[model samples]
Target: MTATAGAPAPSSTGQGGGPADDAGKESADTGPISAISPADSPVSPVSPASPTAARPLPPALPQTPTPSPEGSRPSRNAPVRLRALDGLRLLAALMVAAYHYGGRGGEISQAWGSSPREQFPTASTYFAYGCLGVQIFFVISGFVICMSGWGRPLRSFFASRVSRLYPAYWAAILIVTAVFALPWVAFKSVSPSDTLVNLTMLQQPIGVDRVLGVCWTLWAELRFYALFALFVVLPGANRQRVILFCAVWTLGAALADAANQPFLELVLMPQYAPYFIGGMGLYLIHRYGHDALAWGIVGLSFLIGQHYAVAELWHAPNPSFFSYRSTLGIVAIVAFGYLAVALIALGKFHWANWRWLTLAGALTYPFYLVHEHLGWVVVEVLHQKLNIPSYGTFALTILLMLFLAWLLYRFVEQRLTPVIKRSLTAVRVR
Candidate 1:
């Protein structure tokens, strides 16, 4: 495996588990790494692992994406290469970790309210804003999925998506459940019904919550996959059609929000669709050159995305979590926009090719999967009993979480994804 491709076993976030040797300023493979084909091998269009072979760009992304002249846009039998978005992935994951760490201070404070409480005041105050990372993740997901899905069959896409999501997710859920299920530190009890529900990663739609709270986002991610899969079937689709389809989606969301239609909002993914849409806009620019349609999508996404922040202002118990000094109405806008700009830089700048950043990004999905509740439990237990300052506990917690994420990446997601892919890819979608 190249040191920075393949990730997440299939959920939350995944760090790259493929080779890092080829993460150049101009990425040449359609993938960071693939199980069916190695990066250096002669391009094989028939390989099940060719994630960017000739098919159709999803209709959801209507306008034909601009491609770099030499290496973008594979022909019917051509090879496709994609720049690793590992750096972006890692940045987004860390943001969520920071958000959890910053916000969960209240949990510790509640547990030991009477004691000496001299802890990270600034860390507590500002890091809470890291919650914007989840939105960043959604945008990254949209971009990555589009990159991965180009010129591929729907079944192949499903196999690729499923293989990447499930293994690491299952491992994480089992580990965390075991941790929380212990009697001495029992924060939650897991039952068979919950276990079964979580295994499908559809617990939210079924009215059952996930064993790990973060698994909730998987529902939205899966929904996006379903919608975008339609576009993959329409290889002949044009930009105007894709733009119209997305515009209609946004309108549906706006109408849902205006009428407070909870079911529509929940099913349509209204809260974060614009970010996902915005990410697709970046994908077009990143793969192809700038076009009016792609830029228009980004612009309209920014405008329509406002509905989320505006709605949260009225509904969220903590509105500051959604704001950042008002330079942008929502912190997600700044995060998504920053990342979009960064995508362009990756195309144009050599310095963006740092190897370690890609490593961090590859491990992101696994880290995000494992960090949340377990980290909170550790901080609460360590600081409350041992009298460690919250800062010390927070630092230690981050270290521990990062270490665990590395383990998941190195041992589980990175190692196992290929085996699963080889087997799944061999099935031939009969």
Candidate 2:
């Protein structure tokens, strides 16, 4: 364990999906998601997981201190804004977008086979390896959860998550639905039930078809939030309780993996939880210095779960485990990736802390939400009928995606999120 330096200074964690996991509610020190002038906007690097000697809480926020692991309200660490996390958010989104662009629009069933170099003679060369972005996102998801809940009340935490999550999500749904409705792009005809269910981001267990494939990750994200919120509200929560919870989670994932039960795997969110756990481990090490428990869980997660994660995440084509792929390679790749997230949390990624990038990071949630299906449809027409080169198609699709993502962030999301936060703040005041 290294020294716990530079935890969230006191203001941010954000809307759950991207760097902005709690982007709504008290996402701003003065106002929710206050206007993002480069000179004033926050990079929102990380939020503390427990109370300690924290920076000052925002003046506008009335300090209604709640009991925490450290003792009373006064001792609880106020949230700090970490600047580097926005860079990670954009990076993760780009990876996922690359994966989709290069890999026949990746799904749970996407298989790059044993040799990507040989098989990916075309655009696959570019997009095939990028699917690991989802893994990176899981790690971010775990960190954000702990950061967001650090010392907030249960009602406030839930409200923060809701305000952070729902506005952009609803906007994404409408954007995608409208894209299909316009009729210029070739697309699947989604049923009313499917569209409605997909909007909820809870379609899988219910057996409704997702409006887009990437929506599956959102479901797991919401579930993880639910699980963490429970941890937040349970009697006498603290770091040790969290550690025990993760240990039990790791054990359950191992059992589910050995059993090879697909439905069960998802229900437990086990296939993806280790990466999420790895993230939590990073936060712990950063918060309290390296402890045996945190490091052990992170290492064990990589050792026990890497192979299983690659198999399920990549969905190896031949079906005999890593089959054509190198098992060690998958393990190494995942281990390093998880470690990278933790390192970034420690403010080691200062190079990525440019203020302009926060705008890019803010766009990640919307970018991820709308890109896949629309890009697929557009790329299909551009390649098939218009006969655009792979490179050109990818470039144009990215531009379109960027434009749409920006519109959502600028017009729809930025506007709605603050309103939600203000309403919630009023509730707290009352």
Candidate 3:
């Protein structure tokens, strides 16, 4: 999801209960809270059961509504916020940072006729694993956006999203530009026009890396948001209907990849679409109040796909076949996407919470934006000036980056968010 444009404002609490309470009541009012049985739900792609079906079906159990603590709200501190997600983001960021720094050492070592891996194993592994973080971020974005927008009006949903993401993002680009252009630093390659394009979030449209280099993910995310908005705008956009949309998108993406069609790749990449749908699906299950068993199934599906399944498929020798890659990857992506949704659905369940990690997760966007550049500078300076070992330097650089991220979150992002919100509000009124 996009970094919210405003300060970390708490979601508005509903009277006598919060959004959770309202959601719970709404779920009850809607109907039975059992898992959306493949046979019963129109959203499920399975064919209708025959009257002469071999075995008798078991009676559906009444879903026990998970009890939420009083006065709970979904925010940075929400108990349902998965700590694993934070850990995942941390892992991804470090991977990217290591990849960049490690590659630099690799370049130097090649010139010196030494094995780069021996000198910079940390960097090598990080480089290898860095792109995984981007995948994880895509999944997380899909899940969070889906959960946050579930049952909310499309207009308010879009507004809140724009409000939350743009402010900190714009501020970050400006800060980065200023730093890069400093007289002492003199890190100039980007022009003012380029900076403006990056700020407008259109860097990807013209086929150039944004000012930050890593901002390509933002383009993907924007596309997901636009698609999601379109899905909601279509007639009969309900939980079941959206699930079908996700299934179609997931399968279609796999098909496109198999056909080696570039235009289709833009739409069919599960990373581009399924994760968001999975997130939406999870939110529907949660919003409808499915039992723990259902949540378990979703989680299991996500883990199996993310860890064991996708790795095996992607690591295949000469595995350039689009169908193979797309099929496995899309399943994993959609699975994890749904798992994130499942977690959100059971937002009343408090098991996933970890305060510090949640805070780190909240800082992910800024950390992502700043870590590479700042961490690169730190690693270089330490290596060149102080002659630090690669691993030691890597560790130290990450710590320093994290510290700087904390300061940015506390001082700049935290402060400017509210001001941006107010300005947006005033503009809307006008």
lDDT, candidate 1, 1-430, per-residue tens: 0010111122211211111111111111111111111111111121112333332322222223333333434223233232234554555556556655553333334433432123544554455445455555565555555555555566556566665666667887788778766777635545767767678767767765456655655666676667777754345223444456567777887788678877877756777678667766655655445566777877777666555544442233453332222434354544554455345323433234444654555455666676766775787677777888766877788788888867876787667766675676675555
Estimate, for each residue in 256-318, the C-alpha lDDT of model 3 and write its tens digit. 857988677765544344434444445545444453433443454354335432533344444
What ordering of candidates by lDDT runs from best to worst?
A: 2, 1, 3
Maximum-TM-score candidate? 2
Error in Å for residue 169 of model 1:
0.8
TM-score of 2: 0.75
Question: Roughly what TM-score does model 1 have, to 2 decimal places?
Answer: 0.74
lDDT of 2 by residue, 1-430 (tens): 0001111111111111122232222331101111111111222323333222223443332233333364312222434344455555566666667665554322211222223233345645445445556666666656556544555567666556556666767887776677767766445546776778767756666776556545556666666767777765444346776687789888887788679887667656666677667767776665555577878877876665575545644444554332232445456656666767667655456445455665665666667766766666666666556877656766888888889878877887778866775677565434
Give the 10-residue window scoring lowest on summed lDDT in candidate 2: 1-10
Off by over 4 Å in 1: 1-84, 104-118, 233-244, 259-263, 313-349, 428-430
